[model samples]
Target: MNVLEIRNLTKKFGDFIAVDNMNLSVREGEIFGFLGANGAGKSTTINMISSLLRITKGEIELLGRNIVKESKFAKMNIGIVPQDLAIYEEMSAYENVSFFAGLYGLRGSLLKERTVEALDFVGLGDKHKALPKSFSGGMKRRLNIACAIAHRPKLIIMDEPTVGIDPQSRNYILNSVRMLNRMGCSIIYTSHYMEEVEEICTRIAIVDHGKIIAEGTKEQLKSIITDTKEIWIGVKKEDALDLEALKRISGIISVRLEEQTIKIVSKAEINNLNWIIQQLIKDQVEISSVEEQAPNLETVFLTLTGRNLRD
Candidate 1:
């Protein structure tokens, strides 16, 4: 079953088109990663789906209900964790959860139970009475998530929930997301951090300039690029290596020397490292370290957009 369906979705700001005739479907119980560079219309598209922004020309359906026509019903079933912190600093964690839960019509014992459950799920059960201002960056992020899931909505949309936080907090957020998905909640995740998307998303869609340039599983997306393997070899300062000889290797496409490091780009099937090591041994080139760069979502994004994610 398709939990969300967007057809010919277009949103414009005067002469600039934010989302142009976009169409995509997210399956039920699947973690869909919505990826793009900054200002790529990722937030705009998500805002529209969450009913926080109006569509200029198109149709959006949530769980088989049209967003424009049945907005109240659609909005009620979806949870949103915006990119920025949505909690009040003066309010305690318990109070924050209670407030958002109340918006969903939860009350009395039911509301209290759900609030505690959400706090515990994010590993902040002991800090229920603590105010947001007292929490660390990561803790505050967890509280943001707790408030969003207090209602247990069928679909959860998280936009860069782990940005600008310590590794411990990032891991906490990632684990909580996994736990939620295991409990059968569908998620639409948007982030410039390719590693996070690669870690949790079952399916990914890369959007650029208000359009989806590519969409697939991690392996499937990597397969789109022919050069899948990247080799980095650190050379000692004293090695009298012949650059021309290294370039003569059959599978080796290009070689560049940066300081004491040498980078080799090649096709995915080529075991260029083994051959390079053998040749280095034969030529008496001093090899300090040889590491192969694994194919990642970041590489795919760079190849597709011709720019870095943070750029």
Candidate 2:
């Protein structure tokens, strides 16, 4: 079952179209990775799903009810852990969780029980009476998560939940996300760290120019961008390597000499390694070793988006 569904969704600002006919879906029990560079309409789409922004056109259904028609139902079923911390420094950890959970209609003993449960779930049980201002960055982030989950929404949207935290805290949050999914919550996860998404996301969607350009498992996404392969050849002296000569080889797309290594991108189906080795040997370029590179999530993101870093 799909926990969230978006069809031909769009958002416009005056004449500028922020999101253009976007369609996406997140299945129940999935940690779905939503990726995009800055200004790619990812945030706009998310805002519409959460009912924070009015959709200019199209439909978004959360758990089978159209969000526009049933905004209360949609919001009740969704939990948002914003990239920006949403906790109050003045409030005790328990009070913070209780406050947000109460907004969703949790009250009395039930609210207190869930608030304590959430604190324990995020490893903050002992600090229930502590203020967020006195906490470490990671602890604060975890508290941010506790505030979101205290209500136990069916779907959770975690936007860069690990940003600016220590590695240990990052790992803790990642494990917590897995635990949440195991406990029957569908998740929509976003992160600039490609490795994090690769490690935890069940599937991923790449948004560009206000549209989804790619959607698949890690291997599937890699396959789409693997028509070309990179072979890194180590040489004794980089200056002696002729980049032009390597580029002239059939099926070779591009070549560059970096320090003591010569990088060559070629058609994947080509058998030009032997010829390239022979040419290097003939040119008296001492060869150390050669390695064929495999495509990873970072490779897919850069290849598809034509970018080195996200804004």
Per-candidate Cα lDDT values, in order, are 0.88, 0.90
Task: Please give the distance, in angstroms, between residue 265's alpha carbon in candidate 1 and its true position after superposition.
Answer: 6.1
TM-score of 2: 0.85
TM-score of each: 0.83, 0.85
RMSD per model, one decimal: 4.7, 4.0
State the weakest 10-residue window (summed lDDT) of model 2.
Answer: 302-311
The digit string of per-residue lDDT tens for model 1 on 196-282 reads: 899999999989999999999999998887665668888885366777788888777666676888766666777767777887777
